[model samples]
Target chain A: MPPTPRRGASAVLLPRLGSLVVLIAGWQAAAWFAGSRLLPGPAAVAAGIGEALVHGEMAMHLSATLARVAAAFALAMAFGTSLGYAMGRSDRFDRVADPWLVLLLNLPALVVIVLAYVWFGLTEAAAVGAVALNKIPNTVVVVREGARALDPGLDEVARAYRFGTWKRLRHVVLPQLGPYLAAAARSGLSLVWKIVLVVELLGRSNGVGFEIGTYFQLFDVRMILAYALAFVVIMLLVETLVLQPVERRAGRWRQRHA
Target chain B: MLELDIRRKEYRGVSSPLLAVRDLKLCLEAGRFGAVLGESGCGKSTALRILAGLDPDYEGEVRRPGEGRLGIVFQEPRLLPWRTVEQNVRLALPQPLEGRDLAPLFASLGLAEHRDRHPGELSLGLARRAALARAFAVEPDLLLLDEPFVSLDPATAGRLRGELADLVARSRATTLMVTHDEEEALALADTVFVLSPRPARLLGEVTLDRPRGARDAGWVAERRREIERLRAG
Candidate 1:
């Protein structure tokens, strides 16, 4: 039998809350020893968060960062899944594209951002494009593994049944690739989140990264912590509420049997 | 009707190319069921793959009814784990089928209650039944089975074999099954083709003149001995 909804929710929620309390207590202790100027207590950072929300442009900057992440995430996933599927399906393509994938995978995200800014001249397209570029190879590598792992037995089944392109793709290919897509989406999102901020810090004038950059210049540890906490909270929510749920649903069939 | 004449097939090994099948010929009259009985690793599957048009690298000629659909039950169930039993069967249909239309087929397979269940939730026996249901739903003119009842318990495999024979007779599809089980070959197939080991060659063919339902355990025992004798010779 399945766990009751309320019990299941608490089973997950209580441990998370416990961890948060422990983390805050440690931070508060550190702050009491180091003093507020060096490292602010949790309450000082909370005040900084409230001040940013009310008097500063926290909402605008946060939205800007999110938009970049969304655009880059979508772009990387779309292109990465297609390329990965192609490479996985064809040996010739995989051999041909392998070196390029290696090169891109090893290239640092910072270098890619700097190159994009230099090449595209500090435009929004360049910033988002660079973030996407940094992420695509990782997505491709992961999704290609998924495509490669597809059962040849299922392929024969599809052919024996004479399934047309669309039917075979929907019922056979896509379902097999679902887990890979989820894996790419999860890792791709996290990668994009980190790189988008770097792109903003280096080239773009408006975003959470730029705000963080400004706070870093003034050495306002509280505000930096505030912005960092807010973004971490958003990412945590996305992981728990969005990515985890999707991963669970994609593999729900396995769970029922297990 | 279905016909296969494979002159040669070779696989490239690390050291040298290996021959898999040579001069293998088989023909099944329309609506007739045939079985190819061979030892394991004797390229029975290679020949089946050639017939199924999955191994085009081989030198062969396969003839079937023009525009006729084909259905195959592989060694494994091979059902999409994410799809329900009904949905997997529906996906095999050339045209859409209503739930009510599929209910009887499900009931016939003793899968009426499992229509909404995913393949992962099924026992090995039930999953094989689902695979059989999917094959029949396509209304195929040519049916291929590759050790379809393999790896199941003896009792489960026996029952499924009986059900499969009945279904194939009802559908009247020209079926070619590859198996090592003498009992299965004798029980279901109208003609059984015995094959030699490696670079597979046809040893001999046995035709069961008796109707499938009328074949008794004694007849099967006699036939198994005859097949063994032929294989040895």
Candidate 2:
């Protein structure tokens, strides 16, 4: 017989917790040998986290970082999906845009960020726009493949039924593209998070990246670890709570069919 | 009613333009059932696509009803795997069939219990029935079936063919089915147009004068021999 749902849940959860415990134990062992200032134990970092939370500094910096991530992710996904879909559908558009896409994809993220800062000044628009620009090419590539992989057999079904533009998009095109969209979202989120940190570290005044930079200057290792750990935890939560659920839902049809 | 006079259709092969269909002409009066019988890859499907207004690049004058709707059953089911069977059928309806009792249609197709199931959950026979259901749900003026029962087992194919004949009779839509199966063409169609291999042109057309219900296995066997004799000549 197959495992019951409750038993299955425990089977998945226990190993994850076991890995976390093992990682913390190793970190603590290393910290003890290195001593406190050079490398704090997990307990010292936990204390630093508690201090920052109590002072409300962690909340401000975390929220600021999250806001940047959200803005950049939305911008990249919207523009990239449209551009990619257009390029995929039309041969003329694809030919014209192909070289530019290749160039954008190969362009260094750091270079784009620096150029944005220099051209637009050290503003929020520059920071978010630069991060979005860096991430757009990846989203475009993923979504373009999705659009290209659309089944022509299904396209005939649409044409036979005389499906209008909206209906075709909803029933035929989008459902086929669901997996690719989910892929774009998942990769795009991870890419945007990393770039947003770089953007903040380079120019921003008040985010986890800026806080980490400040801690680095003072050589406050515990506070730096604390902020890093907190941000990691928050991102993990978003992945599990928001992104995974959406992906699972989008792909539920496949699971059921399989 | 439908009329097709396809002059030519060519595919860009590695070295030359491979012609698939040439000078293929046929006409079907309204409420008549017809089948284009040909070998696989003989452009039968390409001909159907032209009639259905899907392939406009061909040189042809296809005179179908100006404002009529089309319901096509592809060689494969071509169902949206993500949509439930009923959802797939509902999507093909020309207008919102609000408060409509689709249970009867599903029951007739032997799909009543599987309406909520996705297409992948069903067997090949059941999936074809779902495709048939989707086509009939629209009450289409022209119904196109491209080898609807080609890949099924013998018994399943026989049963589904019977169900299809019954549905087509009731709907009375001007139907055009393409099949390589001579038996299937003779069994279901009022008129059968035999087609040649590549650059498919009409070989001949046979109009079965006898009603479908009166034609049994013995009659079909006799007709098959007659068609073979005709082909030889």
Candidate 3:
């Protein structure tokens, strides 16, 4: 059954606390039964996380990974949105580039990462390039479809009235394309982070992914589990703090009008 | 002035052209309001589209005396959902229409309170009013409307038609509209052309020489008789 309506702050916190307790209990019981080699208990992983945080290993790696993801995400958004608009508006662009775009969309992230490393070298550029490449094609496909679906008669009206290019784009085109762009950004962010983590693990000597690899090599199960959990926590933070807020703001306009 | 002769259009894979307004000739003088009245699928919309320069696929001899700009309103409001009502009107303006100037336009249509609101927030009638404002704001040489009031209730449609007639009279824009309603065609147009269905052809023209305000029951009865004759043929 769905929980009853929570009327107070404490009522809201109750479920979260209950879920946490259940998770810790289950992990502790499993660790005691299996021993530490295969599955580190909650206490062991917490200790590893604490040790890494105090020594600055966790902070350094976390910041490096976050910075890379952030840069790649920004580049992806810039390229994808512009390219999507062009592809949507021009039949010539669609004819020439659509097949290539579809191929890129279907290409595996690993293959793109490998190709980028080979072409650009195993540097910061390569990692970011890999993530950006993986992200851009999907964004282009989604946003281009959005652009193509705009009403032709409305566009004709704009043209007949001699609306300047900027005015036409801003007032007529951008608003219609907002939701599609938002959806693409949301999905692109998730995919880029995951792909960036994998790319870091495969080659980079830094980042959360590299730290997890290091822990694996040393057979430190608790440290590996700690890094994985930390990454999950970061993903949740981004979803709640960044993406969800934008989604809600964009949707607010739609709701108010609808 | 605008003219079209022998316009023909067809989509692929059919036995014949979907629209063949053959030997169709129109000589619309500047600043006159004309209406095309016909049943559904009678190619009235196709003619309007050709005038608006949207359907370039048609073969036709077209002539316009000057750089005549046209603002076309389709059946739907077609306002960008993301834009506020003010922004939608602004789309029709060549430059940013000043807020003070826009206020009276909005007030005239009973939409002053909704200027900042998005199109999706508006009722169907209000949305149509915004669309009309968008068209009027353009200050076009010619305005083409394809059944712009088809979806509205009779009272609202009547009110909008009256408002539009006044706007056209005031602006002096050459207007060509397509509608199936005999009352609407007769009420708003200076000249209404009745058309036959399928291979659509012009039946005859009813010249409403009386000014818009003079339209009453007798005027409507005369138009009904004229439409009945066309339908019977």
Leading candidate by lDDT: 2
Against the true structure, candidate 1 reaches a TM-score of 0.93
Candidate 2 regions off by >4 Å?
A: A1-7, B96-99, B216-226
Order of candidates by TM-score, top first?
A: 2, 1, 3
| lDDT, candidates in the order shown | 0.88, 0.89, 0.81
Q: Give the best candidate by DockQ.
A: 2
Error of 3 at B2 (Å): 2.9
* Residue A143 accuracy (lDDT) in model 1: 88
After superposition, candidate 1 runs with Cα above 4 Å error: A1-7, B96-100, B216-233
Per-residue lDDT tens digits for candidate 3, residues B18-92, read: 544654667678888888888888777877777777668777777653557666687888887777889878756
Q: Fill in the DockQ of model 1.
A: 0.71
How far residue B35's Cα lies from its native spot in candidate 1, in Å, is 1.4
Model 3 residue B60 CA deviation (Å) reads 1.9
Which DockQ values do the candidates obtain, in the order shown? 0.71, 0.78, 0.58
Q: Model 2 Cα displacement at A114 (Å)?
A: 1.5
- Predicted structure with the largest TM-score when compared to the true one: 2
The order of the candidates by lDDT, greatest first, is: 2, 1, 3
Compute the TM-score of each model's chain A versus the native chain A and list the values: 0.94, 0.94, 0.85
